[model samples]
Target chain A: EDKVVQSPLSLVVHEGDTVTLNCSYEVTNFRSLLWYKQEKKAPTFLFMLTSSGIEKKSGRLSSILDKKELSSILNITATQTGDSAIYLCAVDPSSNTGNQFYFGTGTSLTVIP
Target chain B: EPEVTQTPSHQVTQMGQEVILRCVPISNHLYFYWYRQILGQKVEFLVSFYNNEISEKSEIFDDQFSVERPDGSNFTLKIRSTKLEDSAMYFCASSALPQGYRQPQHFGDGTRLSIL
Candidate 1:
């Protein structure tokens, strides 16, 4: 079975503080990794990492993948109260059948004012 | 921006009853998927549909669960028999292509199903 594990299940940080969330996975055929942000309802797409070393960035958020270690990290710099939300990591494994996406129990972030 | 839309922001049903959740994915997207998240739990994959057929499904998707494109724009998930365990937030997602490496899925605001 494909498995994904995220570290620091919960984090509490003050506004303007920087935080990093980690995700590691074990799969038979790894194709790509994706990150999502969930506030109260639906999750919104963040970044999809396919290659290692290169970073994908959007505003204050950036993520990088390490294929050699089978892990990825999401960094949020100068975080604001609006950035407080669950950060989810999912992996897509290569299969002859349809694409299967496995998600890690997300890291819940709480940003204090 | 185009978004996937789901009807009935919330639904309450009795056990053993049948329920159909509706969704209309982003126009022009070819692949569709259904996922669920129990409160305080990880989001689980239920099924994926493409080319008017089922491309993949998880063990959670048993005989009681069925999906259909039914019409040109709507995708539906029907649960023949509901259980208390079935209470969760069901999400509909769509992507422009089948290849994960090419297109990432966009999710809808999910319908919260409460089974009594």
Candidate 2:
């Protein structure tokens, strides 16, 4: 079974502080890693990383995948109160069947002003 | 931006009752999926539908669960019998293609189902 694990299950940081969330996975055929932000309900797409060492960024949020290490990291710099949410990481494996995405438990982040 | 939409923001059903959750995926997207997240738990995939058929389904999707694309716009998931354990937020997602090769899946706000 494909599995994805995330670290620092929960974290609290002051505004403007930088935070890093980690995700590592074990799968048969690795393909891509994705990040998502969830506030109250559904998760919104963040970034998708396919190649190692290449970082994907959006505003204050950035993520990178390390294929050799079988892990990924999401960094939020200059965090604001609006950044408080559950950050999710998911891995998609290369498979003929479409049910290959595995998600981590997620990291709940709280950014206080 | 176009997105996946689900109906009935919240639904409360009694145990052993049948329930149907509906979704409208983004137009031009070729793949559709159903997933659920129990409160405080990780999201779990249930099934994926494409080309008017089921491409794959998880063990969570048993005989009691069925999916259908009755029309061009709407995809539905029907649960034959609900259990208390079934209470969770059900999300509908769609992708132009699998994440590895193409766009990532976009999710709907989700339907919160509560089984009493």
What are the per-model C-alpha RMSD values against the true structure? 0.9, 0.9
Question: Candidate 2 lDDT, tens digit per residue, A20-108?
Answer: 99999999898888999999988999998889999998998999999999999999999999999999999888874784468899999
- Candidate 1's C-alpha runs over 4 A off are none
Question: Which ten residues in a row are the worst by lDDT in model 1 chain A?
Answer: A92-101
Off by over 4 Å in 2: none
Best by DockQ: 1
What is the alpha-carbon interface RMSD for each candidate? 1.2, 1.4
Model 1 residue A45 distance off true place after TM-score fit, in angstroms:
0.4
Residue B100 alpha-carbon offset, candidate 2, angstroms: 3.9
The Cα error of candidate 2 at residue B116, in Å, is 0.7
Q: Model 1, A112: alpha-carbon shift in Å?
A: 0.5
How displaced is residue A14 in candidate 1, in Å? 0.2
lDDT of 1 at A88: 95
